[model samples]
Target: MSAAREMLCDTARAVFAEAAEAGMAPVEAAGFDLLLVPEADGGFGGDWGDANAVLRIAGVAVPDLPVAERILSGLGDAPKTLHAAATVGLMAGAMGQALALSIEHVNTRQQFGRPLGKFQAVQQSLAVLACEVAAVDAAAAAMAARLDAAGLDAEAADFEIAAAKLRANRAVGIVTAVAHQVHGAIGFTREYDLHRVTIPLMRWRGLHGNDAYWAERLGRQVAGFGGRGLWETLTARAE
Candidate 1:
């Protein structure tokens, strides 16, 4: 990355970490949204650029304290209860899934006939978990970008947000499953936190729309201009 990009990422990481910490408190912090407010909101206005910057940091923090909900809620006139619920749901689900994976590794991983988190495979899983976390962070950033540019237009911004949530939701499953398999039998235990993320991941999959639903929606969007004729229509419209 360029020096400038690196600088921005570093700055965003710092602010996001602070925000994430505040978000984890027993009570929500004051003016949390103001830090990421768009100019239209009468604050130091920002766009997806700002939101993504914040989200990437928040993902790193993964505090599970409803940080994303509060941020998204503060953006407009008030967000509906359902909207806030969905926002927080996705963020919470993502964190839960990741945590579950870690717990699974630590418990089931046996090395030298003991827990393998005591060994190498478990360590590898941890690395993979980090990558998954980073991917989700990037997805959050991308979703914020679409929202900033397009507002809440269903075809544009909503679609992008849905896509992001969809990917994160699916990832919750993939990460959890693989981690559990690697963990062996102990991952199924009620004593594990892995279940916490697994339960939410399952719920989130159906909460909004699933992969097939979103895929169809995206397909229809591409086909809306007249199936294969969309490109022609676009060219003609441009002309």
Candidate 2:
């Protein structure tokens, strides 16, 4: 990450961490909603790349407010809804929290006189969970970079955005299943914070365009290119 991006992410992390610690609602977390709006528009003027980092941090915090939707509404013509990349970022954030919680739980919780993490079964499950999280994060990051480089209006970005959301939606089910399996009964309980991330992930997967929806869209886009145009279409840039 560039120095500027790192600093922005750090600032976002601090804001989200403070809000989570204080039990503040997501919307009530001050300054977050302004990150994506242009300064000329009476906002911070940060772009989608900056908002990508913010959404990841918010996902980890899993606050009660709709941070993703707020950012989307402020940044574009969308009807106050979570866009594909934002949804991916949100799921990535949730997976980060879930993975950390699962790791902590496995290391602390014991069975048969050893840490749960020491068990081979648990190790394999955790490994899969980690891979899923990494995949979603990578896809979201790629889409963010694409958007930043091409400008948000560039139609060339649609394929990558759709692919990221599709990958994220698919990964959520696997990540959530593995996380819940790792956490066992404690994960399902309302008292534990795992539900905060897991529930939102589940809900977010169906929003924007779900896996099936994106798959169809992608297929149609590819089909329209035909055999001769396939390679160029994949590599094409918006005019």
Candidate 3:
């Protein structure tokens, strides 16, 4: 990441952390909505990569704000919700926060006179969760990059976006399950912040498009391409 993008993400994380701690409503953080807007429109002139950064941070923070939606829409006249890129970004952020929380818990919480993290079972589970989270994040980033590069190439962008959303949705189920399993009963409690992230992930997975929807769309697209053309179609760059 560029120094400027890193700084922007840091600021967003801080702002979101404060809001989540304070139990405040998820209001738009100052200047966040402008990140994806064009400079000609008096906004930040950032690309999808920048917006993905903000969305990931927002997911980690677990704030109630529509940061992902705003960034995806560029605060334009378009409908604010159900943007695939933003939804994937939000899921990635949630997965990240959940992984962080699970690791902290395992390292601190004790069982059999030792930290839970010391147990092989717990370590294995956490490792799996970590992998899932990392995969989701990578998929989201790839989708954002594809969107940025493809621009008006709907076919190229749609394939990637669908794949990314499908990956994210599947990851959410695994990540949330492992997170709650590691946290045990406490993860289900209202007082714990883990719910803040996991719940939103569940909700966001259904938005934009769920796993089944994306899977079907992707399958149809590939099948329609026929066996002979599939490889070329998948490998072709956006025009």
Per-model TM-score on C-alpha atoms: 0.57, 0.85, 0.87
| Candidate that would win on TM-score | 3
Candidate 3's displacement at residue 221, Å, is 1.3
Residue 235 in model 2: shift from native, Å?
A: 6.0
Q: Write model 2 residue lDDT over 1-239, tens digit each, in one string.
A: 76877887887777677666665453455666677766888987776778888788888775455777776666567631237677778788888899999999999999999999999999999999999999988888778877776666436577678778888888988989999998989999999989999899898889887789989977887788788787785465322
List lDDT for all candidates, in order.
0.55, 0.79, 0.78
Residue-level lDDT tens digits of model 1 in 145-205: 5555565333455545555666666577667666576666766789955554555556655
> What are the root-mean-square deviations of the candidates from the true structure over C-alphas?
6.5, 3.2, 2.8
Selected candidate, larger TM-score, 1 vs 3:
3
Residue 8 of model 1: what lDDT?
51
Among residues 3 or more apart in sequence or in different chains, the pairs in candidate 3 whose N, CA or C atoms overlap within 3 Å are none
In angstroms, give how far residue 205 of model 1 lies from its true place.
2.3
Q: How many backbone clashes does candidate 3 have?
A: 0
- Residue-level lDDT of model 3, residues 142-184, one tens digit each, is 6777778865244557777888888998888889999999999
Q: What residue runs in model 3 are displaced by over 4 Å at the alpha carbon?
A: 18-29, 73-82, 152-155, 237-239
| Candidate 3 overall lDDT versus native | 0.78
